[model samples]
Target: MRPRSVRARATLGATAVVATALGAASFALLGILDGNLVRGAQADAERQALATAATAAGGGLEPVLVPGRGIDFLQVVDARGRVLAATPNLSGSPALTPTRPGKPGTVRDTWKRGPVRGGQRHRVVQVTTVTGGGLVTVYAGTSLRQADTADETLKAVLAVVVPLLVLTVALVTWRVTGWALRPVEAIRAEVAEISERDLHRRVPVPRSQDEVARLAVTVNATLDRLEAAGIRQRRFIADASHELRSPITVLRTQLEVARAHPDPALWGELVSGALEDTVRLQDLASDLLLLARLDTSEPPPDTPVDLAGLLREEVRARRGGPVPVEPDLAGEATVRGSTLWLSRLVANLLDNAQRHAERRVVLSLRVDRGRGTAVVEVRDDGPGIPAADRERVFERFTRLDDARSRDEGGTGLGLAIARDIATRLGGTLDALDAPRGARLRATLPLAAD
Candidate 1:
């Protein structure tokens, strides 16, 4: 089957609806007019019959016997069933009996012998006298031609008007659809003109506060996000390349220096320094790769996990430390997530706490009663992060100025990785200001049945 054009489909549907409504209205009007016309014709025939009966009853037979202009036939019968007078055409028939006297009666008797042009169905009216000896009847009729003619005329007009109406409606619908979609077409053309090279360009926003305007706003917002993501991707690539180049250059220079030096110990020391740089570079590259995968990968695996148990295990694993460790775990806090990733997320926070705490580190995991959220908090007595640098510390490769020396041996990606994993699990990781030292909290959604 051939596919139908959208414009044609829209126009056809609109036309069909309008035509159906018009057709129904016309049919109802025609029925009412037909009923009224038939009723009026019946009333006129009855009036003529009444007048004829009255005239004949008031005088002798001659006036009633004469053929009246519009009256088809007339007959006067006495109470004893004798015809007083009738028109020539109806004279041969037997004298009519008074079925009802002194009152009106109707019958569907035929009148072939009338002065009317054609035989037709008619209503008969009877008149009776107070004296029991006499009665009068009058007959009048109309040909069905007038009613037939009116019907034919209506049919002919409808034949012409209905098709014309359908055509006019189809045209109007087509024009209206085109007018409605004009803005959408313009938006499509403008969007086609925009490419990666011209992301600064935007589609024109329509002034009207309609659905089309809302659609345009949504499209513009999507475009803005794409542009921002593209810029971030370019920056990430440039930064990665710059970071990788430094260690590579240092390794190459160290190798060259060792090749030129004759002292074995000096050469060994240079080699060891190069090895350490190589290890650091490797760790940075691995962390970057992991961060990239986390951003782009699907949702984490959903498995039953006792979060309190996981925290206790992590705390026990780090039993020996410069700082005293205390853990407060309560409730059966079960969650759904990748165990490996969740362990890494928890481990990163604990390691950061251990490295910076002055004397004590406290870890706690429990479900918050009011909010119904699973909260895991790690606090320490060490110097806490300053308010100005708290947000910056979660970014990749960001380090505190006080801990920038090579001896720190941190890749500065620990908090970044932890935050990314937390986000993927539909949780939040944030630093909280504490009186003694820094406090970090990870809040996860409570598992719902």
Candidate 2:
């Protein structure tokens, strides 16, 4: 698009984005603040209701009670919802709300009448308790005037601020876009000449220290990154093609031999072999998809996870096989991460260990509160890894025993995926030296209490 068109589009897009964001944020802020204020009022009223209900249960409540702090009024009602005792201001008045709590816990509601001054609403809380007389309900309430005032004030402020902020953003975006587009013609001409064959070519940097100059610098840096990314992408594609060829070749060769021979006796073995290769291909494809996502996707939102609990579930699921898994899950090891990613991480580690174990896999999860790290250790009694190849095994498709890995349907991306997940989760996976087996341990930052 031309500079004028780009300028217009940039201005409108930025303005729209900012305006929408601010509008939504304003509404959310208003709602959250209003709800919090009302909840605070309700909490205070509920506490007052509980205290008064206890008093009524003890038969110690005064007929004309004094309202608690922030409480507008208090009433002790019987099972029939008849007001037996009330605040002095509400003396001889009937029940404020005919509806009573049907259960044993605190129930809150909003009522506009009964001490709702100046068109304000009131938050009413009811606490039910068993007294000597029978089941009694204590009603307590507070005005929602503060919450209403806060909501109104926020609405007024946002009414003025949102438009002004949006207008400011529009004007600023218009000006900055024009400035950034000043050298777009030269950049366009230069970039148009930079084909895949000559990705190293960069746009001309303007002499002046302006947006165009900075734009030129950024464009040049971007070209550098693109050039590097292109090289890496080509290498990845080549390596992936080479790795994929083995299974395709095996599957194709098996099908061709069976088709040429036409042997009914060998049908089962041929089908089993094809199915095995097909499953390996599937595993490879899934691993590649995961690795690609790990390469480009952002880490998911974090939530507190109990790594010990997660490990326990994984261990339980992987047990009752030829290779039993023993778990020594001890202590609290809570960490913040996507549970899906964490589960995959544990699965990969355990899977790798289980694949390599001769008889059993030992899974250990411990909390290092002194260091604020959660350690998950998986050990297998297999032919131990050499000291020099510990880190090498984490590299993509870096199988030490390629023949064995291929036969066992290993994609060789398990450890790589685990390490990537651990890194994205702000953790580290390492192969540690063991006495008679291979031990791989992952350390993660513990979630805050």
Candidate 3:
């Protein structure tokens, strides 16, 4: 079977419930009206019958009582049970005895006479009267046709009214349901119009604090985040292009110069210069790729790593001369991250410190307080970064003018890559002010069990 639409199903359900309740109420009302009509008609018939009986009683006893057609049946009996008078179409002696003189009685009964085809069914009202020393019993009954007609009329009215009311209810329900869902439809249309280029655009928030308005607020907040991310992505791309273009241009120019001169002595120097540019380009490209991958990849694999062990190995591998070193592995200092990325992150911070420090670089790994985080601090005796340029130093391709000519062999991406890796590993890197030089702190989330 084809699935029903929500509107149809909802409307149908409402209609069914309302129609059933209304139908039941209608049936009950019609029954009550029919009963009341029947009772009123019977009372009217009884009053008319009593009036006819009274008229006959005022006349002579020998005179015959004749009721008009369609009004009632009339009969009179003496004390001996003899039928003294009756209407023309009625026959046979009266079955009931005459009532006592000076006394009155009333009763109801069904009277049937003659063959089935010619017979008539009636509801009779017997009125007894005392007359002449004996008794006379008079019967006057009205037909039930009027009461039946009233009942049928009530039924007809119900047949028309019930359907009309149901139709009205259905139409009203459909319109009201549609009106209630109008806001949702508007929200959907507005959301469809939004795209990446138009992340600044937002869904209209209603003034009301209803659920739809809350949903709009939430969607707008998400769009705000997306817009910020897009801006960052654009800035990153622009910065990457500017960083790559300079080295590439220099390499190309040096190669062109060597080609034009064709001198072996200068050729080697030009090739070396080109090779240096190529290495710089390669480092820049690799860092950019790593940053991109880290931004898109899953959460880093969290494994327990000994911060002190990793630091010892990195310090030993450093080509730069280290004046003095101290290792203080306190509280086990275990953290969670991909060991390879975490090692590179620490190695970068150490390398940066090693390049800048004049005499000594102190490494520390320890956990303080109840929090399960490993802190790796690399403090040096060299000149520290200026407080104003601390944050800028972590940005890609951002090297201080003085450090630009320093023989650090860095592509200026080490700190940027370190920060990216730290962020991905649920950690952070910051340059702290120290007595002699800068103290770089790298904090990573500790491994659980």
Candidate 4:
């Protein structure tokens, strides 16, 4: 069942249980009331019967005893069960009850009494006393019809009212529950209408700051993130296609020229150009794949690697002319990271520095044992990057200078990859401001000794 429907049924069920309990309590109270009325009738009859017995013992029953105060019958009998005196209603009849002596104030149930037969039940009280030098018994009885009629009336009233009360309570509970969940139903409807393509749409928020409103806020926030991811994915695809098309077009054009000219020198030039474009294409495809893997790949295993030694080795392998590599690696600087990734990070930094340096590229590595960090810096003396462009330099396919195009041996992904790897390795890489040129610094946690 739906949530609101289940809530409605639960509310109805609880109200029904309460109504049933109240009905049962009311029924029990009625029973107590009916019993008390019958007891009061019996007490009055006993009092009247005792007075008649006293009268017969001292004087005569006909002058002292009176009837018809809610009592049905009265009789006096001697020890041999012969009627001595009785009210007019019980005239010429035998003893209504046995003349045997019983407890002083005991009431008994009798079915047949003093010519009144047909098994009609009556409440009787008996009193015994000495009269005319012999023992005599007095009985007073009353019909049970009035008390029984009252109990039946109460029962009938309860039977009608209890069900009506239960039904009314159940209906009221159902209506209240439905009213409470109306906002939740509205939120569900609004969210249901939103498709994947309509992630920009938000669920309607209620005015109250309850859980339902909070839920609407959370859902809308999730939609916002999904929309941003969608936009980024579309832009990434377009940029990748644009980057790939350039190399492929160049390769096709070079091959076509070689086919049409058929000159030996021109063939050599064409082959070199084609090979360079092929290498560029392969590198771009590899960078894109690595980025995709970085997005989903688990963190690499950590191991101790000498950061200073890695920097020194990358600097020594430099290919360009007139760019002197100066190293200021002070001591053993080791950090916890994957060796392959650390090597790539240093190579990317050195390559970027060598490309921009006029005549000198400086590499520095040091470990601050007090701070528990290893710092590596690559500085060059070429045109410095502006402060506004530092952060953008780490974004994919971003380049500040249009003159320094892809043909200038820069893929525009080296810094982005380096930053991503450093982050995964629990480190940070940033472009720091320098006096004359650019400085890129990487900080990583030092390995435990």
Candidate 5:
């Protein structure tokens, strides 16, 4: 699964996204924080100016103002910019920030270092009114010290908090990613422990139905196949040992007998028998070698082949034996496969049929265009195969009758080799029922356009 890469990419992407979002949000918060603080102070100054203008409109404008709650300075002035009323602290002072608009609306400005108590900074607002005594204006202001202090305090707090939040998110992302990849690590470690000698061992599968769990399952399936192949290999080795020993023992015994007797007349007879056994051993070795090649080698390139022509050639080779062979050669049916191996498959089937036939054997080749396959049928008028043992006959080294002599029984690899070759060519060989005997039918794919 290469879980480290998955984890690294996931953590990096998540951290980058969160960092960008939090950074943007932090900047927006800082910009809004100062303005929000200033808005409150300006709103207070506007309200106080409105109140002073209303008082002057009611015609009882006084120079000395009463104590108020919010504003630090308050003054009422006429249209010509003359101070008509003032706060107690500025009883005789000029209008605060009176250089405002000349209409009956509000004008807001910043009160710089001015003639107020100690010249403190303030947010100033001017409100003008349409009165019978001409246009009158009121000026009111509030200190900026508190709003400025709070804005600075919040900026300092956020400078510390944003980094902490991003760090916390990154830590959480790393831990969660590691947790998700833990199962993959476990699967890798377990598979690493599996050797050829440890083929019986299996990797642990997780309960979750996620990608990692599926990966674990696929690895387990591959291990199962390897284990099964190992078992079959060991079994073949055991069977090969037993089969090889039999002929070698017979050859050794015949030689030993001839050596002890030293009979010139018996020499011919003993030599012939020894030659027959040697041939049998040779054929057995050849069959074993062919089977080994089939098992281990990569598939040979498939070329166009004439199945009917190949069948006729094989039938001709097997003629003049004890059994009279009949050929039913149909029209040309082309298929695609390795010529040597396909010929081996046909020869094996014919050999098997001739050995089992009583008096008659029929070899036929037909092509079924509807099914896109070429079929080869070899029927023998002998004891037919039982339905229960049909599939078992194709297994290597399996003989239905163990007591039968080796000559009649053959090497027990003909049908097995035939089936293996058929399978390698993407075809099937099956023992089917016949009228009076057994029929081995091989179906292979027809060469297409």
Candidate 6:
């Protein structure tokens, strides 16, 4: 057999259960009604027999012999199972029932098989009477044909009506289920039409604030996030390509010039210039690769790193730099983060400050034990960034004219990388207002120890 659809199967199963219940109930009701009718028929037969017996006793049995009412069988016997008087329809036959006479006014029910009445089933009532001579028995019976016919009619009607009712209910249930699922189907169709290339498209939310509507809203929100990520990815690619092209173009031009003129005197300067460009390109590519890795990298391990020690080391390492760096270390500042990333963050700030400073750069580290934070600030005596461009300074490849000149050995990605690394370590980096220069501050969560 072919498998049925959900609606069809549900309808069929429900209808079958209802039909079975109704069928059983119908049968029980018919049986009860038929039993009551049979009992009523027996009672009527007994009543007729009693009336006939009373007439025979009062008027000597001859008037009842002429046939009274519609009782089908009647017999009078006197103690020996011998018939004393009978209706004309009996034709001098024996007693119709096997019930014997007992105490006066006692009645009993019995079944009789008749010869003259075509052997049909009859419900017979036997009544005992005490007369002037001896105790006599009176039998009365009626055919069960009429009650049987009524029961048969009831069965036929129930058989037709129950199935009709079940079918009607099944149809109504199917239609209601379909109507409720209509919105879900619409959402499925709309979602099917969406593709990755058009993540800007959104699923339609129904007016009702039910589960299906909430699902559509959540799907649309996810699509919005994907669209934003796609835009950022495209912009990153374009910017990277533009930045990479500059060095490659310079390399190609310098190689072409060196190839045309093979003068030994120009070769030294050309090689030095090429080496510098190559180093700059390498540093830029490394920074870009680190940023890409950070996009998918797991959270850094939580290891206690002393911020004061790291700052001191960074300043000592840059001792040979052209600008003077003033260190203001207050206490043993500790934070929770990867030592490498935290060090890189500090180095980026120091490098930016060193590059922009004309005479001096200030490096400060302070531990706020009560606040549970480690704060690091690098201040430069260079022309400070404007208030309007403060937030934009941390964006990738964003460069102010005085801060990120080509001759200053700055790739314009240092601050961006530093901010990203700081965020990953549960810290924040921002530029603060300075009187004569730029002040960059980084705040990191303190280590438990």
Leading candidate by lDDT: 2
The segments of candidate 1 whose C-alpha lies over 4 angstroms from its true place after superposition are 1-8, 43-140, 144-146, 149-165, 321-325, 355-357, 381-383, 386-389, 400-407
- lDDT per residue for candidate 1 within 1-449, as digits (tens), equals 43286667899888889899889977886787766765665566666666666666566446336644444566766555666667777666766443545554554433333344455434344444332335555555544445556777887898799889999999988998777767777788989999998777777778877877888888899899989888877876776787688778889999888888867889778979899889979877887888888979676778877788888788888888667679988776877786788898988888788788878889888797667679888898888989988888897766685354235557667888999888888899999888878899999877665
lDDT of each: 0.74, 0.87, 0.73, 0.80, 0.83, 0.81
Candidate 3, 26-87: lDDT as tens digits: 77876887567545545654665566556556765434555655445566765677777766
- Full-model lDDT, candidate 2: 0.87
The regions of model 2 sitting more than 4 angstroms off are 1-232
Q: Write the per-residue lDDT of candidate 4 for residues 1-449, one digit (tens) a residue.
A: 53446666678677869787987798787879877876877887788888887887896667224575878788887778878777777788766645477433344554433244334456787888887747778888876666767887888888898878887878877787677678888878887898878878888888879887898899889889989888877877888898899889999999999989989989888999999999999989988987887677686658888787787777678745568778898888888887788988888888788777898988898788999998889899999789999999898887777467565767788898899888888889999988989999998999888
Q: What is the TM-score of each candidate against the true structure?
A: 0.76, 0.50, 0.63, 0.62, 0.70, 0.61
Model 2 lDDT-worst window of ten: 111-120
lDDT by residue (tens digit), candidate 2, 307-329: 78888888778768778899998
By lDDT, the candidates rank as 2, 5, 6, 4, 1, 3
**Model 3, runs deviating above 4 Å:** 1-180, 297-299, 319-326, 381-394, 400-407, 431-437
Lowest-scoring 10 consecutive residues by lDDT in candidate 6? 62-71
| Candidate 6 wrong stretches, greater than 4 Å | 1-187, 368-371, 402-404, 434-436
Clash pairs detected, candidate 6? none
* Candidate with more favorable, higher lDDT: 1 or 5: 5
Question: How many clashes show up per model?
Answer: 0, 0, 0, 0, 0, 0
Better of 3 and 4 by lDDT: 4
The candidate with the higher TM-score, 1 or 5, is 1
